[model samples]
Target: MFRNIKTYREGALIEDEQIKSYVESFESELLRGISTLSALSIIQRHPDEGIYGYQLLKELEQETGRTLIIEEGTLYPILRKLERDELVVSERKDSGGRPRKYYKLTTKGTELYQHMVGFFSKLLEAITPLMDIEIKLPEKKFIYCPNCTNKIPQEAEVRFCNICGLNIEGLSK
Candidate 1:
C-alpha cells in the first residue's frame, strides 16, 4: 500500500526529497503502538471528569503539534483494548441531556502512565546530547527515580518510586 503524497503537507514530513520517505517512515514506525500512551495522557489531564473520543483526538493533535495524529477509526479499537485490559474504565454521562461515554484511567493505569512518562522523558534526555538538543528537566518540581526512572514529584515526600517500589527516601538527602 502506498501512502498518498498529497496527504502530507509540503515541507512538513516531506521536507527533503532525499530523506523524506525515511523520515516519514521513521516517525510512523516510532509512533506505532503509542496510541495507548497518548490516550492515557489525555485522560490523565481530565483527572476528575475524564474525556471523550473527539476531545482526546483534538488534544492529541494540539499537544503534539499535529505530529501525531490518530484517526477516529483507529482510536475506538485502541480504547476498547485499553478498557479490556483494565487500564481504563468507561462511564456514560449525560451532558446537556446528551449521553456520551467518557474514559478515566484506573489506578493500575495511572501507575503505568507515570512510568511510561518517566521512561520516555529519560529516553529523550539520554538522546539529547546525540541529537544536539538540550532538554532542561525541572528538577525542582520532579525527580527521576534512580532505580526505574519513574518520575516522582519532589514535594511528595515519598520513600519509594510509586511505580517500581524502589526505595527513594535517601535521594532526598
Candidate 2:
C-alpha cells in the first residue's frame, strides 16, 4: 500500500512497523544511570584531580539528576578494578580532619581515554544522521530539461528531468 511505503515523524524516516516494534520491545538497557562509555567520559573530563568514592557518587547523582544511583559500595569496587588494571591510581589523602581514598586516572588511563574519544567521536558522526540529530545536505544540481525525473550523480553538474521537457529550475537553489 502507498500508505505503508514511507512516513516521516520528528525529523526521522522510519517504517510504521519499525516504530511499532520499538514501542513494543522497549528495553531499559542503560544501567548505572548512564552507559559505561559515558562513565569513562566523565572520568576523562575530570582527570588529573582525584575523586573520592563519595564525591564521585555525588557528582554522578548531580550530573544525572539522581538517575544514576552510584552507591559507594558499588563505586569503590569498580575503582579498585580500574586501579588493579593500572588504568587508575588511588591514594589515601588527609583533608583537615578526615582521611579519604582518592582515585585518579593513570597514564594508561589517559591513553585509553584518548582512544575512546576518537572511537566515540567517529561512532557518533556516523550514527547522528540516522538518529535525526544531524542530516546530510543534498548536493547542488542543475536540470538540463524540465521533463526529466531521474536522479543525477553527485559529480554531475547538470541533470535532465525525465518527467517534463523544460529544464528543472532552481535545482541548485
| Highest-TM-score candidate | 1
In model 1, the worst 10-residue window by lDDT is 1-10
- Kindly report which residue stretches of model 1 are placed more than 4 angstroms away from their true locations once superposed: 1-25
What's model 2's lDDT at 81? 72
Give candidate 2's error at residue 151 in angstroms: 37
**Per-model C-alpha lDDT, please?**
0.81, 0.56
Among these predicted structures, which one has the highest lDDT?
1
lDDT of 1 by residue, 1-173 (tens): 12334476666646666587776677666665576788889999987899989889999988987767876678898899989999899999987788989999999888888888888888889999998999987767778888788888888878878887988885754
Rate residue 147 of model 1 by lDDT: 78
User: Taking the tens digit of each residue's C-alpha lDDT, what string does model 2 give over 26-55?
Assistant: 422334323444455566666767877777
- The 10 consecutive residues of candidate 2 with the worst lDDT sum are 141-150
